[model samples]
Target chain A: MTQPSEKALVPFVSVDNMMRLVHHIGLEEMLKDLADYVEEDFRRWELFDKTPRVASHSDVGVIELMPTSDGEAYGFKYVNGHPKNTAEGLQTVTAFGLLADVYTGYPVLLTEMTILTALRTAATSAMAAKYLAPKGADTMAMIGNGAQSEFQTLAMKAIIGLKTVRLYDKDPAATAKCAENLKNSGLTVVSCASPQEAIEGAHILTTCTADKQYATILSDNMVGSGVHINAIGGDCPGKTELAKGILERSDVFVEFPPQTRIEGEIQQMPEDFAVTELWQVISGIKQGRTDARQTTLFDSVGFAIEDFSALRYVRDKVAQTPFHEDLDMLADPDDPRDLFGMVQRAKP
Target chain B: MTQPSEKALVPFVSVDNMMRLVHHIGLEEMLKDLADYVEEDFRRWELFDKTPRVASHSDVGVIELMPTSDGEAYGFKYVNGHPKNTAEGLQTVTAFGLLADVYTGYPVLLTEMTILTALRTAATSAMAAKYLAPKGADTMAMIGNGAQSEFQTLAMKAIIGLKTVRLYDKDPAATAKCAENLKNSGLTVVSCASPQEAIEGAHILTTCTADKQYATILSDNMVGSGVHINAIGGDCPGKTELAKGILERSDVFVEFPPQTRIEGEIQQMPEDFAVTELWQVISGIKQGRTDARQTTLFDSVGFAIEDFSALRYVRDKVAQTPFHEDLDMLADPDDPRDLFGMVQRAKP
Candidate 1:
């Protein structure tokens, strides 16, 4: 069979190559770089074409397609959320993404976004924290330690100059796993038996529990004044970590309003509940963390633009690097209208 | 880097392998088989989860994602339509698709869909003609002889026992090329200079011109009663082939009403224009070709379910065949919550 032309080939970064990339670029440094990319895109969020993710819900799980375009390049991520997957020894969420040229409608990059989504989610959380967290914050109470716990801690450390991480999970084994993963890191790691104990002396609180229910991981009394709450776990409908009373007390910030209202912690609130758009803060159009005594909460539900930013960052980083391999993923006939002839000639 | 596990590996069929598979199972036979698959899916159309394709239109072209799901499997195709690309010696349309297991949320197959799309489009057109075309119809007039012309002709011949194809294109070179390509397909081929001459003595008239305008390719006077009109061009808004008068005189059959209303030839008609859903006819819930004197028009805009059937068919065909390669596209860790640990352990 004849080999496809160069234009027909697309660069693919596999899971192994993605891990190699993280180590090669240094996990902390990459986290910091991804944070910068996410911030840059967020700062100019108006130029993007955004839509709430298209989701297919079934009896067991939900599959979603998150797509966005920045005029020049179009990107989308195929992700699935199945909380029960962990019981079957599978990640609760697994994803991959594609970036295509808008002019020619050809794919430029395809990569495993499971690890990238993990990295970008952390980067986004840390980016939000940079603007919403209390000034000179040094410690973050990490609640519900799971797959996202380590990345969140590292991103906070890399982006916000954090000095300490206090970890807590209902499952002691999960907390042990998280603490062991970050044992050698520069930050101080403290394991606590309860959520209340983890919040001691912590200026920022990060919750990332993975349960598909409306159970509250943080009560109104558990959260104090003058601190930042980074709520990343309460993403989908029927899933939330903080009580409605906490939302009433805290000035909430969100990524996209249309999506956040449906999937974020704000789902517990009424339709008229007001929340500040996070992009306005990043763009300097709106105020963030107005006063030291005012509580602030960053409701993160994972947006398509963040994934677009990660795709753009990876596309630029993999250039002339050994981390990607080209796959013949498109058909390019010498004569544009001779596709059938091209196939007919490949007979063997 | 450590090799990914079997669960992380997704089977991928490249362009070369797709062409090889088509030839391995003769093109004509494959077309016939694809028709059966398409018809079978249409018979059970109510079970599918359908949506109008999510399209992002740019000034120069449009990129679309068509997604659908059965109870057990989910599939989507990423396709782009850039008519200007042909002038650059590139395909006007390029596509790739994915199929995933709904239960696991893990991708089962990924394949190049440009060739498969052409095959499926033709098969779908032929499948529609099986119920709508007049009995003993053997001669077809194939207008707009471009990339899809040969497949359209061959599919008609293979599915409905078409005996002769009269080809005509505004570009004589396109008609010449299509005529030469189908010369040895066991059908008598004729090259005509004008649309009038092409439709002479023909029982099926197929129009597939590629102009992104609402220009008429077939007028009311050019079409006669008792013939099947297969209009595959004029898809998308602002694109239509037959004049409104022709549609007024015929019984139109469509794949999905909401989509065809926006992208099919019926776009020229009023919002309440009467049309029959082809799936209804396939399932024996509605009538088709009630009388030989009744004019029948099959407005083909293509649907996600047809692509789903094609993806399912390809997944089954490539199972034990050497027509596919494994892609390490997913990240699976030993402990589902230990994704960070998986990446950390891969540091080398």
Candidate 2:
């Protein structure tokens, strides 16, 4: 029998190419679909090998590598968080990731993760909100409006029918930009002077600030009885958003306990702090938003599995479109031992 | 900041492009230069934040992510080890890696590691041989010639003056092919049968087998005094080369102990096994090859820092070359926060 034809190569989505994928798919469809992938991956959380990311701390920022494997597939992302970056006209965090076949170790996809991370973070927030927020909740109060502001706004609109958004930032220009972008998106946008005004009568509170120290954005006195706090900023050992009083009094939820205890809002709490993993809630192993008046909080430190899901989703979507490019990811030698021969053959 | 100019985009070295780089650099000089980088990094080992790689294990093989950072630069490699892949016409191990600016988390270089790894590993072995082997070493006994054979041969020639090489493989055809390729390299090559025949009087003994088990390629009795044994196989948990008596009788050196303890030939030893780190020797903190009468072993398990050096070298070399491609690896928005707006503009 003749040898089988060579398999089609894997597609790659670079940073520019991924933005085009987002433009082609439309942000709303991408976020709504990404949330589904996140939810589904969370439901099968037991199938994955999970670990807190490996981080290298510097005087200015912390660079980290997050990796995970689902037996047959493997993925990892390289990311950095430097709040001082924006002053230099750079992103606070820029990232990229790779997807590989576990059995052969060939990288099938490599894509820019700056935009993708923002998209996945928002999708993950909306995903947790779907389970922890009161059904039919349509208004969100987003504090710390910066690069991540629009993503949260779009995800809320796409996944939960969010119709009104109240925005707040220490910088007024950020809030103005957020409000301006929300125009004609079928959402009523309001700019708030302070965190107190942003939270007034809103169904969800999303905090995506870029501070590395413990500075409470929300106090016990400001939280409503039934509001869901989507805490995304307090994600390092000493960084936090909610005061200890708020966390001690609310129904707390987190992504991974081992990591959340050290990086999420619970990082401010005692090591024995009580919390539930989002997967537990998704699996129905535990209850979420038990009563209409009970408060809920999702401490998002950004897990590896979320990136895994997002990479796979974008990897699939971009392949079907012409937006993706091909990356040189592995070396295929006729005789594996002849690595030198491969170079020799290229000689002029 | 007139749109940050598309010309500023970071370029990527895909598998196809990386192969071109190796071919352009030529095998001998590439290995020689890679060894220089590895040697340089090892000299400044204290500057880097290092950790043992994080791995996910499966029945077939294991996949690992190795990450390291030197405050300003960050790097990681994705690699796998599967001894049975040759039956399927695949390399027993395949890999790829990236190097990024730690300050911005922007990946500046995305490269193929399958060929690069072979280059680095051989350079590393040749590096250790430089320090631990007898100063006048010119003949090397190579056993289990497979995917990594050519790399080992060339690296030894480039770094350690390996003018005579005795080759042995389970498949005689593999040994024959290795000799054919090195016909014009100004080296004397020999094809031998059995580990005993290959090791007769060579000054260096290199076992680069791909079997992922504990089978001994060379027994302690076969090792001559003053010969440096470069153990290239047995990188993961259940694999090794020299028998227990061999390590027990020799001064075993390693790349990183915590990692080598789990993946190197020394894994068969006790947790308290005393092995000098190669960096110490490179840094002049520890003695290497104290006497020709002593049997020495270099336990080689690849490290992430070496990849960092290789990546930096390739990136610098590519920047000087005329044959390079742009990959658009960054997402620098006119306003960084307007990543969402980029999607809107990408539309016709």
Candidate 3:
């Protein structure tokens, strides 16, 4: 058997390789690096081709393809959101992504993005917190402690200098698991009984629950002024986390308006409601947090470009390390037109 | 290292496996089977969720994601088209696809579709010819002798019992290569100098050229009444093969209307021009060819449902054969909520 040519193989980062890569870089440093990549992409957001994710909705859940490109490179993520998956011992959201060269139309990297999405989502939240959270904010109240809570805690500590994380979930077992995971990470992990108790003295409120419908994890009265809210879970149509009153009171910031309008907390508001594009804020074209006394919200419905950034980061990082293996994914016939000949010759 | 559990693995059919599977079933038998699957799906087309492919177009080429789903299963193909790729010793189109279980959002199969797409496209074109071509049509004139020509030739033979294939290309080397490949395949192969010579004694005229512009491969005067024209090369916007007068004279059938209006041969016709949906004809809701003198044209711009059917076929076929390997592509932790813990435990 002949070895596949280099052009026929794509670098694939598996789940174990991703785990090993994270451990190799250390979690906080990886988070910071991911945040830098996310911020950098956001800063040049206009250069990217953006479209609302193409989704196929079913009675049980929705499967989506989110694609974006920056002219030179293209990326897309195949992700699914099934809130009931955890009940069957499966992850609620499972994902994988690919990064390809636009010039050659060749995939350069294929990676398991379930873990990278967690890291990028948290890093995106923390990056927003750096711009929107109150200055000198040292504590974050994490509502709905699921798979993303620990990454959020570490990202805040790495990017925003946070020292404490207060966690709460409707399921106390989830909160306990998150707290235990963060125990040795140098943060003062506080487990709380209620969302109200979790946000008592926290300067940043992060809500990332896993419900598939409209459920207010944080009410208007529970939210205070001069704090940033990183709302991560209300990411599909008819699914929301913050109360409508909270949205009315806060200066909401979003990744992409068209997508945020359909799938974020803003989905609860009127179509004509005002919101700021986060890219504009990062580019200094618009204000993020106008004043310390104002409430700010980062309505983070995960974007394709962030996944693009995560894929880009991983593609670069893995090239410098031994965290990838080549997979023979493309069909490269010796003569491009002799595909049938190639197949015919492969007969056993 | 522990082996990945079944839930964490996706069955991957690489280029080699796809070729082996094609050989195992025999190419003509596979083409017949693929055409049957395509016909079955087209008969129940209303049950499918159809959308135009999501494409990212660049100066040189285009990358697209075509996604579709029935109520039970979902599939998507990631493909790129670069006409200049052959000049670089690469294929003009390369693809891979995934079929997932809608119930659990887990991928069931990932297969290289570069070969499969060739098979399915040929199958689709031939299947349409079975319904639209004149009864007992035994000869075909294939205008473009590229990667798709041979597959198209074999499919026409399998489905419509084509006895002779007359091939012609702008490049004689391409025509010669195609002729040499089909020499022993039980068909009378004729290599022609021009498109007019290729169509001299043919009842089915198939044009599948590779140019990206709206050049006329088949002029209006060259096509007579009662011939079934399989115009496949005019798939993208601004890339039509047949002259407009030919379309004006023929009874046109298309896969999906909105897409055909943009990318198919009908792009040259008026927006309000009449055309029948191929599904209606397959299901007997609409008439195909009413008389022997009526010219029928299948303006095929490959639809997502066709790809879905192909993916479905490969998924079922591979399960019955040992032509696939498992890829560890998903992250499955002991507890779905402890993804961070899963990473931490992998520390070296």
Candidate 4:
């Protein structure tokens, strides 16, 4: 039987390759590059075909398919979130994604997105902080120092010139892990005993606890008037990290309103609560950080466009690189109608 | 960095491996096995999580993600349909699928489903015919003999004891290719000039034309009483095969009404049009082929559960076999909360 052609092959970046790719391009530089891609896609967000992620919720966790297309390329991520997984020695979130050409409906790249999701989620937070954080902001209060804390702190350092990260988690071991991971990353990592102490003198307050219930990791009293809140953990319904009072006091910015209304911290807010679309803010059609004393909150639920940007970034960077292996994922018959003949010829 | 643990590896069946596996098991035998799986799943269809496939349609083609879970395992197929692709020497339809453990949210198997889809689609049609087709049915009129024709014929032969296949296509070359491919498959092959001629002595008529627009391949007058119609071509909004009159004459059976109502031959019917769920018949809740002179139509748009069944079948069949390779598709950090540490340790 003849070998499959190039068109039939899809470049797959494994977790090992993804980590190698991250190191190949310095981690700090890669985070900044990803932030740029996220910002770029947000600028033209109207062109994307957006849909609320289709999710299958079970008693244990949730599996979701987030899909979006830009008329030229289509991308989607298959991600599962099981908060109980961490107790079982597994990552709470594991993901992989595919990018396909819109013209031919053929996959061009397939890659593990577990590491990429961490990078993109943090980069998106940092990018939002770039616009919403106070001018000359350099300190961030990193609450819930877990898997995402190090990336979040490093992204802030790379994108917004953050010089210090104040880390605090209910589990001190998690805070220690985040602090140790970022110790040599050029940021002054300070381990704090409490969330209140972590927010001291910080310009950005980021919360990313992994509890599956509505836990108030941050209260209204803990947040200062001018500090920007990057809330990334309240991604699913009933999984919020901030108190409802905190949401009422700030101007909430969201990815997609219909989705954010269901999954973001705004799920606690009334349906009529006013919020700004982040794309409009990025495009300069709407205001962002107008006053030094006004609180600006990025109620991020990690939209599909962000993942599309990340997928596109990896696809472009992996071109002609050793970071990917081609898998014969598509069937390419000499005659499109002779698929049976192709299979018959491969009788070995 | 240390090597990823077993939990991070996913078994992947490439196209070559898939073809080898098919040949290893014998195509006819494998088709029969797949039919049994499809039928087995159909019996418990109500236990599945069903949703209309998430589709992203562009001017030229469409990309879709069909996902479902049966409480224990989650499965999804990434498929695309670009009718113009055949002109560029590419298959009009291509697919790949993944099956993940619902408990850990970790993928167990990933496989190229282009060939598998052909096999499962045919198997599903034959499985439906087992319950809907007349007893002692021997000949099948295979119309629009393209990529799916030969599989449909073989599946019918293997699952329903079909002895002869009469082929017809708008393009004679397609019919010729299908006949040539099936010449050695033990079934008597008959090539015909018209669709009418193909059905002269056939007990079952299968239409699988490739047109993206509504083109009636079978008029009402051409469909005789008591003959079973297996329509597998009209899978999108503007695509269909059989005439509206034929649907009116036949008792239509569908996989999922919400999906088939928009993509199947029933799309031409009213929103309130009467149709039976094929699963009900499989579970013995509804009658199949009620009378000798009653027409039965299986409007198969292809559902997520069927793909789920096919994925389960492959994962089971490929176990302890050399038909698949392990893919490092997920990131398994030693400490679930120390993903950054994992990446940092991998800096080579």
Candidate 5:
């Protein structure tokens, strides 16, 4: 029997392939590109179908599913966050994602999302600050400067034009490491002792603490007016960051309301609490920060569309540059009906 | 410098390894063992954390996420059903899944679920038949026999003592293909012309049609009293197999009620419509087939726990075999904080 000439399956982006792309492109340029992808997707929001993320929680950590579609393609990310894992020598977060064609339901790409997720999270923050923060915001106070700190600095510098960084972590070694990494980048980097000192006079306050409990990283007194608060931690049920007062004072914008409501700072507020979707702001369908003195809060719990956008960017880059391995994952059968034939034909 | 020890990396069960497993165990033994695994998992349903599958719908088809945990471990499957693709010469459904350690939140096994899915779906049906059908029930009318027919036949013979299967499909070629595949089995097979002729005098009725639209493969008038209906195909927003009368007349059993409300025959009913959970029945918390002469329905839209059960089974079996591949998907640094070192240490 003759088989129809089928379209060649796309190459899969693996963990090493993605790392090579980052190394080749330079992390700053890649983060900026990823930021651009997020901004571009957010601007054309109406062309996509959006939904809140679904999560399954346990005592140690949580596994989440974030799914979105750009009308033509569908994507989702599976990520797990276990803060204590760092002590056990495992990264706090590990992820993988899939991109499928909506027309044919064929999975076009499956890529390691660990590094991609880090880049996208930082990119999303930078994208949000572009419209939500004051124009030409220069200095960012990064609280809890750990594994995610450098990416945020790179993204903000490459995308939002940051010139200075103030770092603070409960562990002084982490702050020293952050400072050492940013020492020769031509940007002025300062190590602070307390959260209060970190946020004294910064244009953006990025809180990405890794604590799994409801601990307040930022109080109302520390956050000044006109600063964009990028709340990245407190993304699960019982985990939270910013004090209730910050949420009350700021104009909060979220990726998806239903999801951020449960995972973001809004979890502390009533269900009727008002918020703006970042896509709406990007699409110009809704307003962002109303004035210069208005404190804007981007309560980001990370959405799937950003990951989808990131995946597309990585897939495109992988094609242009010679980096990637075919995963040998998809079962390509000669006869679609005879999936069992694959086993029967295999040589022992 | 020496590369970090490989103790942190997780093992991957690639499609090649899965095919090798099927060849080593042989299809019949694998089907029978998978059926036992599913049956055992169902009986201990109360021990599992069950939730409705999350579904994302599109104009072309629907993609769904099915996740479950048994306190000890968690598993999830990413599956898509685009029935129209077969006409376009693509498989109607394709899937892959992961089984993770709930305590540590690390993926212990990742397996190609396309072929395994076919094996498990048929096994689940036979398991349902074993409990719901009468003591001497030896015949089943399999309507819409396509990719799933042979496994259904073999699983029934292996698990439920089904000695005969009256097969019928709108396409005569499909019916012939099914008979040809199952010719050596002990069960006597008959290819019928229509749904009405197929179900006539049969002890059990199973429907596994593949369409994204509402398809009434079994009508109200065609079903007889004391018949156990295993409805397997109607698994998305607009897809359904049984007539409304069939659902109303039968004692309906379902896999997670919220999910069944969206994907099964019960989707046509209201939010408050009554249905018994198959898990509850299997756990003896509720009853299965309350009456000997009353019609009963197993609205099997497919559940995550069964996949979880199968994943555990496959992962355990694969661990015992030499066929394995190292995906190298995880990022491990001697110090988890030295993520930056990963790039610097890469031997370019």
Candidate 6:
């Protein structure tokens, strides 16, 4: 049997390899680097191809393909959201992503994106907070401490010099788990009994509860002036995290208006309700936070460009370290047109 | 490091394993089986989620994601087409696909689809020929002999009892390579110098050329009445094989009209051009080949449902054989919300 050529093999970072890569890079440093990458992509966001994710919805959950390209490299992530999966001891969201060369359409990297998504989502939130949050913000109130809480808190610490995180979840066990996970992460972690206590003395507020319906994790009264709300959880048509009154008061900013209009907190607003594009703020085309007294909100329903940036970052990092294994995934016959001959020759 | 659980493992059929599976089943039998699967999906096409493939087109090539689902299982293929890749010793097209359980939103199978694509394409052509070709068709003229020629020839032999295949290509070396590959496939293979010579006494005509732009492989004068034309290569915008005159005379059948209108041979015709859905014909909702003197054309640009059916078929076949490996692709933490804890514990 002939060996597959170099072109036939795609570098794959398994879940175990991803964990090792994070450890090797140090989690805080990785978060910082991911934030840098996300910010860089945002600065040049006009070059990317953006679309609302293609989703196949069922009664139980939804599966989606999020694809984006930067003219040179194309990337996509296949992710599934089944909130009920947690009860069965499975990850509620599982993902894998690919990066391909736009010139050749050949995949250069394939990686487990469940961990990567968590990392990228946090990085995106932190990057947005850097542009939208009050200057020198050092504390965050993390409501809905599920799979994303620890990462979100750590990303804030990494990017914004946040020194404190007050965590709260409807389930006490979830809050306890999050607090336990962040105990050694150099942050002052506080477990709060309720959402009101979580926001006490915090400059940034993050809401990321995983529910598939219209549930308000943060009501208008729960919010105050001058705080940046990093909303991450309400990412489907009927799912939202903030009350309509809160959105009406805050200076809302979004990743892509078309997508955020369908899946973000702004879905509660009228069709013509105003919002700023984060890319415009990052590029200085528009303002982020107008004044110290006005509230700013980063309504982040994760977008494909963020995934594209994450995949590109991983591809670069994997090439620098021996953390990826080559998977024989493509059939490269000696003659490109003799695919049948190659199969025939492989017969035993 | 802890071992990933069964839920984290997705069954992966690598290129080598896929080759072994094909040889284990015998190529002709596999083609016949694939045709059966394609036919079955066509019979119930209304149940599928059909959309034209989502493509990111660059100056050099195009990368696309083709996704479809029944109510139970979901499948999608990541494929790229770069015409200049063959000059760089790369396959012009390479693909990989995944099948997930819609109920759980978990991936069940991941397989390399380049080889499977060739087989499925041939099977689809043969299946269409079975319904649209003249009765007792035993001879086929395969134009533009390339990677797909041998498979197309053998599939016809297996499904429609084709006894002979006359092959021609603009490049004689491609024709020679195709003829050499099909020598022992129990079909009388003839090498012709031109398209007119290839179709001299054939009842079925297949045109599958791989140029990225429109080029007439079969002109109008070369086509005869009462013949079934299986046009496979004109699958992208601006890339077509059959002349406009041939299409005007033939009773055109398409896999999906919306897709065919943009990417198939019918792109030359008007928007409201009369065509029959192949699925309708297969399901007996519409007629195929109403008379012996009528010219029949199957403008097959390929569809997501065909790939979905192919993935499902491979998943079932690999389940009964040992020709597959388990890939630990998903991060299955002990507690779904404790993903951060899982990563922290993996530290050395």
- On TM-score, the candidate that comes out on top is 1
lDDT of each: 0.94, 0.83, 0.92, 0.93, 0.81, 0.92
Tens digit of per-residue lDDT, candidate 6, span B136-186: 889899998889999899999999899999999999999999989988888
Model 6 chain B: worst 10 consecutive residues (lDDT sum): B44-53
Worst window of 10 by summed lDDT in candidate 4 chain B: B83-92
* lDDT, residue A177, model 1: 100
Question: On DockQ, who's better, 2 or 3?
Answer: 3
Error of 3 at A142 (Å): 1.5
Per-residue lDDT of candidate 6, residues A193-269 (tens digit): 99999999899999999888999889889888999999999888899989999999999999999999998999999
**Candidate 5 docking quality: incorrect, acceptable, medium or high:** acceptable
CA lDDT of B297 in candidate 2?
93
State the lDDT at A36 in candidate 1: 95
Per-residue CA lDDT of candidate 2, range A112-144, in tens? 788899899999999999889987788899998
- Per-residue alpha-carbon lDDT of candidate 2 for residues B186-247, written as tens digits (9 for 90 to 100): 88998998878998789999998877778889887888788899998878778888799989
Per-residue lDDT for A1-348 in model 1, tens only? 778999999999999999988998999999999999999999889999996788988999999999999999999999999888888877788899999999999999999999999999999999999999999999999998998999999999999999999999999999999999999999899999999999999999999998889988999899999999999999999999999999999999999999999999999999889999999999999999989998999999999999999999999998768999999999998988888889888888
Best-to-worst order by DockQ is 1, 6, 4, 3, 2, 5
As a whole number from 0 to 100, the lDDT of residue A335 in candidate 5 is: 59
Cα misplacement distance, residue A236 of candidate 5 (Å): 3.7
Select the stronger candidate by TM-score from 1 and 6. Answer: 1
Off by over 4 Å in 5: A1-10, A132-136, A195-201, A223-228, A237-252, A266-277, A284-296, A341-343, B1-8, B193-202, B211-228, B236-253, B265-276, B284-297
The TM-score that candidate 1 achieves is: 0.99
lDDT of 5 by residue, A259-324 (tens): 888888889999999999899988888888778899999998888889999988987788778777
How much RMSD separates candidate 5 from the native structure?
A: 3.5
Worst 10 residues of 3 chain B by lDDT: B1-10
Candidate 4 positional error at B115, Å? 0.6
lDDT (C-alpha) at residue B252 in model 6? 97
i-RMS for every candidate: 0.9, 4.5, 1.3, 1.0, 3.5, 0.9
Task: Output the lDDT of residue A304, model 1.
Answer: 98
Per-residue lDDT over B1-348 for candidate 3, one digit per residue giving the tens place of the 0 to 100 score: 434567999999989888888989999999999999999999999999987799999998999999999989999999999888889987788899999989889888888889999999999999999899999999999999988899999999999899999999999998988998999899999999989899997999999998999999999999999899999999999899999999999999999999999999999988999999999999999999888999999999999999899999999999989889888899998888888888888788
Please give the distance, in angstroms, between residue B139's alpha carbon in candidate 4 and its true position after superposition: 1.2
TM-score of 3: 0.97
